[model samples]
Target: MFKIGELAELAGVSKRTIDYYTQLGLLEPVRSETNYRYYPEESIERLRLIDALKKQHLTLEEIKERLQIIQNQPDAADEIVDKIEHLQEEMKHIQEELLELKPLLKQLNEQQIKLMTKPLAQQGYTLLHTLAILLGGDPFIN
Candidate 1:
């Protein structure tokens, strides 16, 4: 267990930030008998996850929602969170690549875009939806 300042140091955040996160229900710190808050070792990784998600342009509320979903799961919460963090990191790279292609994509008219996506759409509607959500994009963009 680490005191608030210790946690902040290890997580590379300010004590006030950790306090804010704790107040926002993002981090849970155990209160010691002496009235000091102590965070578990897991808080370091949790902070990292929060940082990564923030970098992806998710709002604090969205990050809280995602964290709630992960924590609410009955099984393997740590494992699931780890996988999600990994997925988000991968998506960030993919998003960058897609941005590089966005100019070329915008040059295509409706019919050309349809022709390009038809094969991808044929592969699976679910795939497209999943990719859209992961990339934080509109699934039905005009």
Candidate 2:
């Protein structure tokens, strides 16, 4: 356990910022017998995440919501790992397919290459939608 000053220093944040997060129910610290606030080691990571999200331009409320989801989902880490592994496999397959396509691409004329690329560029939006679905929908899309 660490006192607020120590935690703030370790997390590279100000004590006032930690206090504000505590007030907002973002950080929960334990009260010592002497009534001093003491944060656990995990608080350092939480503070870092809060700072990173703030840097990403998320509102405090949005950050709180995202953190709440993370806290509530006990199996999220496992799920994320599985998803990452699956994506890696998919990427490997795509890389192999790209290698196979390389010879065909070399034979294509400029006009043929342009036509092929235009459709592939349009498919990028479809890829984005697929990614959004895989990622539990777009939270930042308004």
TM-score list, all predictions? 0.62, 0.58
Look at candidate 2 and tell me the lDDT of residue 54.
Answer: 70
Candidate 1 root-mean-square deviation in Å: 5.1
- Model 2 C-alpha lDDT per residue in residues 63-112, reported as the tens digit of each score: 88878887787357345445555766786897798789879988999999
Off by over 4 Å in 1: 74-129, 135-138
Writing each residue's lDDT as its tens digit, candidate 1 over 1-142 gives 9999999998889999998999999999999998889999878878887887787678888898888876777365567557768877776897797788778989999899898868756866776677777756666876
Question: Could you report the Cα RMSD, in angstroms, for every candidate shown?
Answer: 5.1, 6.6
lDDT of all predictions, in order shown? Answer: 0.82, 0.79
Pairs in clash, predicted candidate 2: none
Candidate 1, clashing residue pairs?
none
Best by TM-score: 1
Task: Name the best candidate (by lDDT).
Answer: 1
CA lDDT, candidate 1, residue 46? 81
